[model samples]
Target: MKIGKVLIANRGEIALRIHRACQEMGIRTVAVHSTADAAAMHVRLADESVCIGPPPARESYLNVAAILSAAAITGADAIHPGYGFLSENANFAEMVEAHGFVFIGPRPEHIRMMGDKIAAKDAMRRLGVPLVPGSLGALASLEEARQVAAEVMYPVLIKAAAGGGGRGMKVAQDESGLEEAWRVARTEAKAAFGDDAVYLEKYLDRPRHIELQVLADTHGHVVHFGERDCSLQRRHQKLVEEAGSPVLDAAQRDALGAQVTRALKQLGYRNAGTLEFLWQDGQFAFIEMNTRLQVEHPVTEMVCGIDLVKEQLRVAAGERLGYGQSEIRFQGHAIECRITAENPDTFLPSPGRVTTYHAPGGLGVRVDSALYSGYAVPPHYDSLIAKLVVHGGTRAEAIARLRRSLAEMVVDGIETTLPLHLAIMEDPEFQAGDYTIHWLEQFVARRNPAR
Candidate 1:
């Protein structure tokens, strides 16, 4: 099960990240790209490259057949679907194994189970994981939703059973709003996920989005890598992420990590996974689990001193997790800002040729990006262009380092969220770590007023 050659069935910064890890492991990489990414960084750095399809994701990155064919032709021993695209697609995982290539992720059943929010919650409950109080399954009718909402109290959230990214989610303040919320949620869910099934959960007034990173191997060993505070979000999309949350102590981290590892062990999970939770009033409630590597994994790696991608490769190659939970240490504080090609104020996509590109450098600073001076920022992919990460001995020092790094970063010829991140770093409330998931929206509103 040695992964000598890997086909990276992804693009952009994550694809480059995986390529670096493979190179470090002495593994050859085959970059699969669309025609639009012919000059991308990962493609240029890879041992070999293959054109998958056109710019649109459906005809290219998401095309399972094209990716499998590329792997077969390249003689790749495995396929690494980095983070997005087919990363969490259970069928794609199965297809990879069926084609005699390793899938560097969890079992297909784990991916399929976690993809369904209701099924995931149920499994978590069975495995003794804490969950937000709500319906045990999808509501069959509006009447059923009403009963569940009444039982859980008002201001309940109507969420699509198979949704993410706040797509099929709505809030009902009271009974008067329940019917509309239900209808809209179902409609959105059907359009987005092709599944009209919706569920209800009691919405917390103010909750911090915290997630635990866990790694498991073919062996029964499972360990958690503390937590990340991803509360600085807009419309449920995280912009800033911090590892070893400012509010959590070592005791709390250990307790939650123990619980997560135990639960994942019971489920027989494997590879790298993240368990997302809502933290409010000192209690953690499981929301969902991502069966692949997360975008903000660098922060965890910085604090834990572990290479998650390398560990993923090792575990996928049937290697044991030689270390255990006790050996894993949470060191200093780390923060990551997701820099996207968009308007700083309006959040509109800004895609064009980059005239200049310069990433910051110094102690404990890492820039994960595929952007270059003359490259064209394609509009076909995610808006995220780079991740600016910084680490320090303390949270205050981390903030100071992040500020300096932000000032040093230069991405010209296109609007990016760099200005927005700089403002966030300067905000007193953010510096004090006194914000929740709603804080970003309010901060943006206060800054704009017109919008």
Candidate 2:
């Protein structure tokens, strides 16, 4: 089950991260790209490169057939589908396995179950995981939606059953707002995921987003690398992520981590995944499980001293998880600020060639990027072009380190969200770790009134 070559079916920083991991493991790498990503850093660095399709993601990154063909032609034994695109596609995973190539991710059934919100919640509920009170399945109609809202109380959330990432989600403050929310959620769900099925959930006001990083192998061994506080988000997209939540103590952290590990092992999940939760008042309510490596994985890696992608490679290659629960250790605090190619004030995508770029240095500062001075930020993809992660002995020290590193980071010739990140680093509530999911939106509205 040894994988000698890995075909990375992604672009940008994550692809580069995978390439580096493969190279360090003495594995050859192949990069698949779109026309727009012809000059992507990952492609330039990979041992072999292939043009998958056009600039559009549907024909390029999301084209599972093209990705498989690239792997087949390039003689790669494994394919790493990074987060987003087809990373969570169950059919794609099945196809990769059918084609005799290992998909460096969870089992196909695991991906399928987690891709559906209703199914994922039902499974978690059966595992005795804490869930926000709501329907156990998709709402039958507006009548069912109202009934569930009555049972769950007001301020219920209507969420799409098939996809996540903030799409097809609407909150109804009361019964009067239920019908419109349901309709709008269905419409958005169909447009985004091609699935109009929606579910209801009790909406917790300003709950903090917490996720545990779980690693497992085919040997039925699973372990957790503590928790990450991803409360600093904008419109459900994480902007700032920190390891070792400031709120949870040792007892709570261990209990929750053990709970997640047990649940994942029960399902026989493999490779790396994340169990997201809504935390408030020391209680955790299950959100949804992400069946792929998260964009904020660097924080967990920095704190735990684990190369998660390397572990994923081993797990997918049928090797046992060599470390037990106690073997994993958490070090000092770490924080990650996602640097996107967007207007700082308006948050609009600003894709163009970077004229000048300089990375921050010194101890505990790591930059995962695909950007160079001449690299062009493509307009056809996600705005996130780089991630700036910093580590320190204490949370306060991490914050201080992040501020200094951010100040030293320079990306010229295009607007970026660096200004917003700078503002967040200086925010009082942010520094105190007293904010919630909705805090970022309010913070921006108050200060950046024009946008």
Candidate 3:
């Protein structure tokens, strides 16, 4: 049951990433793109290409029907949903499999269970995985939310039942805050995910966002590739990610990975996914689980020397994993910086033609991007322009390399957050790995001196 060909059901760097992995495996690739992405790097890199629909995500990347049709026409045996778009859609996965194409991800049921925040937290609790104390189920009403907050104690978090990317989340410190927060959170959730249900959890003050990467197969085998510290973020959007988190000890790392594996086993998960948590006060609590591959997966690949995309394809082809936990080794350190097309100061999108683009390269430097010097960055999609990844024998060396790479990197014509990234590397707290989720807010406040 070897997968000879794969239909990449997304665009941008992730699509190109999967194409490269497929090429190494000798598996032909078919890229499905929108009208705007006809000349995208992913399209040019794939062995074959098909136009799905218009530029909007809903009509193109998220259109399950068109993707299935493309796969059928291209004679692809499997589909890779990269990271975003239809990656987490359980229905899309089911449709792909139903159309006689393997979906390179976990079982649809597993995706459904983990995609919903409330169900995911409950699953973690049932597996004896430590979770942030909160309501065990979705809130029935605002009164129920308040009661749960009262039971969990004040300064709790209100989150969308089916949410991510920091959308539909609010912090309430008092009864007054709970009602207003709930109303606003529900609205945001509906607008973002079309889900109005909200849940409650105790807020971990000054928490570090840490996540474990786990790869499992249809067989009853699961193993972790260590953890990534993604605490440096803006509005819950990960800006930088690094493997071998400086905050965790060997024992803590083992415990965290074990907890994630046990929880996924209980839920009967397969394929590659991540367990996200908030680490605070020397303890970790399950926040949510991503049923799809993450954007920051390259850092894990660099440190572990395992091509996650290849493993994903192999697992989807009904093959047992080639290695065991003992064979898995994490050596050295790796860091990834996301280069977004945005105003450094205002943080607003700045999409336009790329007048100049030069990705830094040398020892311990890798750039994953879809942009070239003359590529016109469309205004319809995300602002992410590139991902700069660096690896070194130690965290300090990795930081130094990243600093040097960032200094050498050049992108002209449009504004970028590179300047802000440069500033962060110079910050003492960030350099020391002492920054938390609140660090960015505080940094902006200090820099602007006014809101």
Provide the RMSD of all predictions against the true structure, rounded to 1 decimal: 0.5, 0.9, 1.2
Clashing pairs in 3: none
* The candidate that achieves the highest lDDT relative to the unseen native structure: 1
Candidate 3, residue 307: the lDDT equals 91
Q: TM-score, each model?
A: 0.99, 0.99, 0.98
Which candidate ranks first by TM-score, i.e. highest? 1
- The reply for model 3, stretches above 4 Å from the true place, is none
For residues 1-451, could you state the per-residue lDDT of candidate 3 as single tens digits?
8899999988888888899999999999999989998889999889999999999988988888898999989999999998878888899988888888999999998899889998888878888888898989878899998889989899999999999888999999988899999999999999998989988999888899999999998887898999999988888898999897989977898887877777677777899999988999998888888988899999999999999999999999888888888788889999999999999778889988889999999998999998889887888888999999999999889999999999999999899989888887778887888888888878877777755
**Residue 115, candidate 1: alpha-carbon lDDT:** 100
Q: How would you order the candidates by lDDT, starting with the best?
A: 1, 2, 3
Model 3, CA-based lDDT: 0.90
Question: What is each predicted model's overall lDDT from 0 to 1?
Answer: 0.96, 0.93, 0.90
Best of the two (1, 3) by TM-score: 1
Predicted structure 1: lDDT:
0.96
Deviation from native of the Cα of residue 178 in model 2, angstroms = 1.2
Q: After aligning candidate 2 to the native by TM-score, how far in Å is the CA of 190 from where it should be?
A: 1.7
- Clash-forming residue pairs, model 1: none
lDDT of 1 by residue, 1-451 (tens): 7889999999999999999999999999999999999999999999999999999999999999999999999899999999889999999999999989999999999999999999999999998889999999999999999999999999999999999999999999999999999999999999999999999999998999999999999989999989999999999999999998988899998899888899899999999999999999999999999999999999999998899999999999999998988899888999999999999999999999999999999999999999999999999999999999999999999999999999999999999999999999999999999999999999999999998
